[model samples]
Target: MTTTSSPLTQDELKAMVGQAALRYIAPGDIVGVGTGSTVNKFIDALATIKDQVRAAVSSSEASTARLQAIGIPVLDANAVEQLSVYVDGADEIDGHGYMIKGGGAALTREKIVAALAQRFVCIADESKRVATLGQFPLPVEVIPMAAQQIARRFAALGGQATLRLKDGQPLVTDNGQHILDVHGLRITDPLAFESAVNQWPGVVTVGVFAHQKASVCLLGTASGVETLTY
Candidate 1:
């Protein structure tokens, strides 16, 4: 008889890292939660310890609903002066801890929540780890009227900027903005690039998280979870 063991799926790896992130949460502290599939798993894990944390400030409306559904109180980021930690997943993460996020169109709020946290703990499957940033299209939230203008600006920088759409219509973010996904970028100096793009008129937030890079990254691999410190 031949027997085979199935390999662990990416979602399973995500769940592992998501559960590992729970240790970073301290009792009685308000946590900042980011948006994404991996974060969804984190929310499920958080539910198991919902009574320990005071509340959570969610980066997206979806996350707010999920947290509420699981009996976790969701607070406004403005009301919270500081969070013990911010847990989020990345589209791509480099060795230096810089990441390209916003694949879920929640970059703006995610950045806000990240800025308010003492520690930013990134949780992701090992596939997200990269030696360089930018394999995934970089998401840039822009003012609707400035979409074309911003695309031109990105084009000048040698990036192919495309407007994100949903259901055959332009996708609108929770903040009522448009997203420009810029392809063909391999960011070497994330901090500088983020600053430059941010200065562009009508640009809301660039996907690069160099300024508020992760303090620690929990990478789930087939072997186990790997802890990487920035």
Candidate 2:
């Protein structure tokens, strides 16, 4: 398939990557969909091949509704025993597959479904790639009652944590909790930081997905889509 010579725009490249993702998905595969612009593009591309595969489980309602609207079947996370593959977008990714997701507030469910998949394929533009995992702020969800305390706790860990808000209100997750975006973490041990945050009282979930690593990362670039395997 020939693409534009002048480098497809970011949105155009994302769409290309989304279409490319379909090739790896076989018929009768139960896939997990992650959140973000790239995944949205993937859903649009998947619509063309909805009948080519089995139903997909989405981590966010936004994606679920989009899939259904495009004639692709949608299933709940618990509805499937094992996912053949998961193609989702990531906020930031490291060489080792350590990532900071949940910019879409679906990180918790995304990670849950990803854990059950044999392979998690992270789709993103070249810009999403980072040398380290924490250059981007990490999103952590907490109960409304404890969001402040959790933010303080995250700050104490040498990171800046702010309760994510929208239009003067705290941003709430699909699980009905507030989100704290932690910035400036030099995370060498993502698992350790994940554990430390989870141990905090009233912490609902953190965006660190160290427990589930990406089997492959599809980076859409001005040049083209480059595949990275961990």
Best by lDDT: 1
**Candidate 2 clash pair list:** none
Worst 10 residues of 1 by lDDT: 75-84
Per-residue lDDT of 95-147 in model 1, one digit per residue for the tens?
99999999999999999999999999999999999999988999999999999
lDDT of 2 by residue, 1-230 (tens): 98756757889978978988887799877778888889999988888778886888989889989988987788877778898899998888888887889899888889888988999998888888888788888988788898778778777879888878899998778898888888888888888888888788997778887788788988898778899999
lDDT of 1: 0.95
TM-score of 1: 0.98
Error of 2 at 28 (Å): 1.4
Best by TM-score: 1
- Which segments of model 2 are wrong by more than 4 Å? 1-5
User: Residue 105, candidate 2: how far off, in angstroms?
Assistant: 0.9
